[model samples]
Target: MNQKHLLACHERILPYIHRTPVLTSRWINERAGTEVFFKCENFQRGGAYKARGATNAVLQLTDTQKKNGVVTHSSGNFAQALSIAAKNVGAKAFIVMPLTAPKVKKDAVKAYGGNIIECEPTLKAREAMAEKIVREKEATFIHPSNDEQVIMGQGTACMELLEERPGLSAILIPVGGGGLAAGTSLAAYFFGTHCEVWGAEPFSVDDAYRSFKSGKIESNASTETIADGLRTQLGDRSFPIMKKYMKGIIRVEEAEIVETMRFVWERMKIIIEPSSAVALAAVFREKDKFRNKHIGVIISGGNVDLNNLPF
Candidate 1:
């Protein structure tokens, strides 16, 4: 979970992953009142920044680990990430995903040689099934966000972005399990212009926001949001890091996320999912805060079925 490790991983992943571009939008800058630049991770391999962490984690696996294989649970993104990463290294990946996971993501996992196990929506249900499958199949457990290696790998995204734009005044990232936020904040501090990093989450699943204010895990009542990629809770490793480095969490409404997604599509010509749009939602909602400043945003996963967009 150190900078050296993250740097080393970037070299390893250079050949395997896409060098997703840092795109600028004049329309976004005018609308958000900030000179905005977006790190288009939605165009990344496996369709999300999760692929960076998943690839680094699997590539560093020991010979014994490769033979034993790995197991993990994801609503979608991380499962497909692990599946493709495991495939590149010739390891078996047992993916326990909810039936509610998007069909595109689930199909990607299958196409990548993943063994899918259906589970209920609850974390308890997913964990129970993943444990059973791991025990039966003798697969190593590759946690979605909690692992230190995964956190370090996730940090590399911010490294790449900050390296490309060192004068960034502030940065925005969508907060799901807080892995990306925590990792990106650390890397921003390392490479950027003393920039403040902010975590953006949909109000539908505003656990990180409440958790930051209340100083404890505050579970949302019921998350009915279009941002399916952002519904997961913060992990033990991620929460402490986010609490230390991140400025604070911004909770955007579901409508804001949808509108931002559509806006980014029409303006930037990028196909991003709702989770990716939360950063834009933050800027759109609080434009004055970002006025006349150099701002950066990480556009996350892009694994959406275009025909099925609720917007």
Candidate 2:
């Protein structure tokens, strides 16, 4: 995707989405051994960075396309985002979610007026179901990742971070499908911000990390992390962008992820879900490396199920 295209999308989306805050914690800074600035995407519309991309994709659609409605397959947050975006654009949203996705996400999609379709938690299965729905209902498909407009929209989070902290040393984002990582990294690269962007992933499902290391695509065993949003295999389109612009991909253990979640909850008094905590875990797991740097980390989402504790 062109940087100009994404830059324009940011301008179009600013009036629609929240300019979520960058919260700094003195204690987190001490623990990470860095000046830690947290871009709390947990505070975003639909409770994630997904909103920016989803809104942009919907906004790009014409009135004729809006009348046809929109369809997408997501683990959770993306569905809620597309549903809310679709609602804003006066279009119907048909969202296909895995049976294993969290209830909080499913409920949020419904609240935003999306029609939910249940599917197995595999991307192949989700795509199949989404296509079937699209064919039957004559709805326009809005991919959760891999679409240029969507990726540009996802880049807005990075734009916001750079705009807020122009001198950031690096940015750490939780990687799932790679849209956020790829898009955000490009934004940093284009702005000449001298910021190294990194992707954080759960070791349990680290296809993106393996892809980065092997210089090719790699799919791990079936989904295994409590962070449902990080299940996807990185896109062919996204892999090149990530490899070119992202500094690196880091994988953290499931235990580390849970520990980070607990720490953020207890200290930040913020309800960040497991996926958002991965970036924080990345820094804590490698405290020696971040000794005196200024790091920006995006907490990708906060729609957690209070009843389910991964620890």
Candidate 3:
């Protein structure tokens, strides 16, 4: 909510999460006609920035609450993040994963010591099962992107980015549930000088973009995007923050997402998932607008299953 709140979150989670590096590529700079700094959250703990929020949430739990543990329904990164964070904080994690979720993600959650609760591949079903577990075990439920503490914690990544590069003209991030976008916008508002914040999302799942324009939450008619991590819609807590601070939302095609993922993997020699590529693809979709500007992109995560490459 404020710089102090974000800084406190950073201080709390600093020892638990990674201060991921910011990297640049001359080729990418020329291609976009902008000096871009990519905050590589892909190299973060649990392979994503989700670790920040999950760890912060876990660490904030009361002693009794920690005894009861925490529960969440996530298809991928957040599941792994909560599992690892809870394990690190000496608490149990109950992860309700959809049956259709990729095997690699499920395996990662298990590796982190999460109790996997398989549910039907629907948001309603996932939430229902998570609630069931919470009721039976008296555990706390943590929404992946909706909790205030989670939002404040997620802002740390952008806080670090802006601290490392104070000259950035703008910051861009992929918007799935709007947590990262909202948090980044807050960081830019509190840290950067004259910096703008933008949200990038896939056209197939442009609910966040439409919600931004309509001033209300919107649900996607289809969930066919290859950005598996972005299939979820924005939450109420993150939506209002995004509306208040975000400059605009940019929608990119599925092909553009795939191409951007390939570009980062082949050109930058770094692995990035489709959801992470959405921000870069949106920048490429509107290169002239950012020409000669110093921009920052949040590479949200890099937990791809190599056997299922989109290319």
The ten-residue window of minimal lDDT in model 1 covers 1-10
lDDT of 1 by residue, 1-311 (tens): 56676788789877788888999988988888889988988888888999888888898889888998999999988998899899998899999999888888888889888899998887889999999988888888988887777777788888888889889989999988877888898788777777999999987799999999988766767768788877788888889888888888888988888888899888878799989999889988988888999989998878898769967
Q: Kindly report which residue pairs in candidate 1 clash with one another.
A: none
Ten residues in a row with the worst lDDT in model 3?
176-185
Q: What are the runs in model 3 whose C-alpha is more than 4 Å off?
A: none
Q: What is the C-alpha lDDT of each candidate?
A: 0.86, 0.88, 0.93
Give TM per candidate. Answer: 0.97, 0.97, 0.99
Q: Give the range of the ten consecutive residues with the poorest summed lDDT in model 2.
A: 185-194
lDDT of model 1 at residue 76? 89
Per-residue accuracy of model 2 over 1-311 as CA lDDT, tens digit each? 67678778999998889999999988899889899888888999999999998999999898988999999999889999999999998899999998988887888899999999999877789999999988998999988877778888888888888888899888899999888988888888876468899889998998998898899988978787888888888887777889999989788999889999999998999989999889889999888766799989988999998888776
What is the Cα-based lDDT of residue 55 in candidate 2? 94
lDDT for residue 232 in candidate 1, whole number 0-100: 82
Clashes of each: 0, 0, 0
- Candidate 3, residues 11-117: lDDT per residue as tens digits? 99999888999999998999999999999999999999999989888999999888999999999899999999899878899999999999999999999999999
